[model samples]
Target: MNRKLICYLLSSLLLLLNCNKVMSASWEITYPRTSSDSDKSTDYPLKVLALALEQTGVNFQLIPSEKHYTQGKNLSRLKDNREINVVWSMTDRQREKDLLPIRIPIYKGLIGWRLFLIREDMADRFKYIQKVDHLLKLSPIQGRDWPDTKILQANSFNVVTNINHSALGPMLSNAQGDFFPRSMLEIWDEIETLQTDNKLIIQDSLGLQYPAAMYFFVNNQNRPLAHLIRTGLEKAVANGKFDKLFNQTYQSYIDRTKLKKRKFYRLKNTFLPSETPLDRKELWFKPN
Candidate 1:
């Protein structure tokens, strides 16, 4: 190569390296791998997160966990690592304390409204559920680390806890738990993945409701990244990009839920973060 061309290439390389450093100076983010676990990994949380981060002009490289952390371990990893710049999960007082929460309800509050998954044969059994007390009698299954475990148990609902996400399906089908509750956005896609034997079905009659939201959480010490994420999300909301993305992503599930037709039982969420923007109607996803 000519000396002039070589000098120019070297300078260009140095400039590009400096730019990457500026972008990734704070944190490298991650979400657990789920492609093998799902037929089509929708990554709604990650999608919204990417949109918000774009507004901030910060550079982020999404590092998939080589540890193969399941949903339960993902929570633990967040508390232990500084490198996990972002993860999207349910927010509670404890999680907010352990990690710096962006406080934007990514799923809106719709994650709190749950639909039941049960054996196909048990659908008729839940049809007569007339009140919260009746629904409480049925055993519900949740991940050991999930906030829903504590949320349901506090409400006097019988809840079975397991650490593995894959095991919940078998446990429910084998009658270890009477039912499993999934959020409105998740039940339709998740049920398709779990119904391997065709015996597992989504119980259509009754739904569970709580006051909760999912937020992007970073390691407690990473305040700059948290601020960057919050700014990104706020910018998206300002430009109408956030709602447009949300509506396009979830419209079919919203149409299918028919919230008015289902009997819903509200449960109390003792650990919900008080800062949750309950006033922001535009941010939350509800099938009304």
Candidate 2:
């Protein structure tokens, strides 16, 4: 072949290869690891998700999000820059907005958690929040500021928002706050190590349950890649790779005994009477 003809052929082949090359997909796992020593180990769960893709012969990259960008805006920026292709866990409206949910759920949240936490000494003062009007009568309950504020505000729950769970104990102990209502698991996790003095108690009497589901959120524009991830996860689950991953990454967290180390007492507030007299007018009042 002539030299010029050979050059033209090479260029065409290069263009074709570039066009056919599979785009690299990556993920940023947002949850924090247990500690600095365990940072690299945190990548294992995401690698499990990646291993599933590998089984399907799908070549992609898995990148764990830096612990510094744990949640909210910082995490959003990592996705905006295309630094990561997926967020490991996110909830409902979040899944609908910025990302697409593939068929397989990386994890499922507990159906719902509604536990009211109180200073151990003050459990008798405030009980489950039954009537919306009754809650309003009780002033200054303790709650976390972020989602709690929005959730409480929407439901018209009368409560004061505290930035951290740690603050609630001292505030309630000092009589500055009423019952601290929040997700059962959240408060339970916080009080696990701090329960040495019988300082805190979690009461699941409010009956306010929030269901949170975990999903892999891919950017909206990357729907095709999301489908690939779905296919990979489906195959993984069928082949038992998913179960192996769950055991390896999460068995410790799911242990009921370990999870229940701190007693989460279910205190029935005076409002919830176990036995109602047959003819009590208030108990039998029917909505007209």
Candidate 3:
């Protein structure tokens, strides 16, 4: 064929293929695989995103972190590579500046509040920890690079960190830290996994309160995907689907924690980004 004719034919074939192809973006999502629940590959916000993505016609493949990496490492890997397109993390001024934040509080700020897990022998002492100063006298265990660790330290609680999530149990067990604070939703599964060590006990009467939230952080260049996910999430929240999912997933924990009855030692979160939607009270959960 002559060059002109060959070019014409190739262009026609390309046009035909384009007409038949479905519009889809293949998204790769990475989540930490907790030893407690394998099925919880996607936390509540990601769950909403998965549903939203389906409505938006994007194809997604969620893969658990093949190698265990901390949230800090997850954000680091969210850059450049297509392997990890989204990372779920709390919004701090620094993180929002570094990554494209979805700006939605995925769990309605429930994860921001904390319950304590101390060594069984220290449970009595923690119960008597009636003030912030008392808790500050001893260090708490936190996952290294976790936003909670920074928040804890910032709020004047001494925090000792472990890079390995699994090691927090041993650190607490060995008296490396006085307590490990966990969310009401997360404590049950984690404490059960660590119970065999016989060194930890859930504090009965007190809770730590803070204004915190978890949000999805996408690379700055990935704004298109961020918009897609954000639009979907907004729609979900507006139409009440998001609230339904939130309650279904976490109401039991709210009941279990008896959040209102517990003596909450409230602390301020100085690191919360100014752009955070704290005024959107409807977006946050309040104990009934």
| Reference-based lDDT, residue 230, model 1 | 90
TM-score against native, each model: 0.86, 0.54, 0.85
lDDT tens digits, residue span 238-282, model 3: 888889888898888778887666888888899998889999988
> Which runs of model 2 end up more than 4 angstroms from their true locations?
1-62, 82-84, 92-95, 103-105, 126-149, 159-188, 193-198, 204-207, 237-288
Give the best candidate by lDDT.
Answer: 1
- What local lDDT score does residue 3 receive in model 3, on the 0 to 100 scale? 100
Order of the predicted models by TM-score, top scorer first: 1, 3, 2
Residue lDDT tens for model 2, 1-288: 999999999999998877566534343333333334523433654675677668656455554445444334433653474455665543444335555655344443321234555677756655544455665555445434344345455555566756554465667656676566654334445556443334767643443444333456666777676777777777777787776776565555444223333333222222211222324232111212
Q: Between candidates 1 and 3, which one is better according to TM-score?
A: 1
CA lDDT, every prediction?
0.82, 0.51, 0.79
lDDT of 1 by residue, 1-288 (tens): 999999999999999999888777754677666646443543777788889878888867677666566665676777787334568889889888878888878877888989988898888888888988888788999998899999999999888989887788889988898999999889898777675454888777689899998888888877877788899999999899888888899888977888788888888998887887888877876554
* Poorest 10 consecutive residues by lDDT, candidate 3: 32-41
| Candidate 3 deviation (Cα RMSD) | 5.3
RMSD of each: 6.4, 11.9, 5.3
Estimate the overall C-alpha local distance difference test score of candidate 1: 0.82
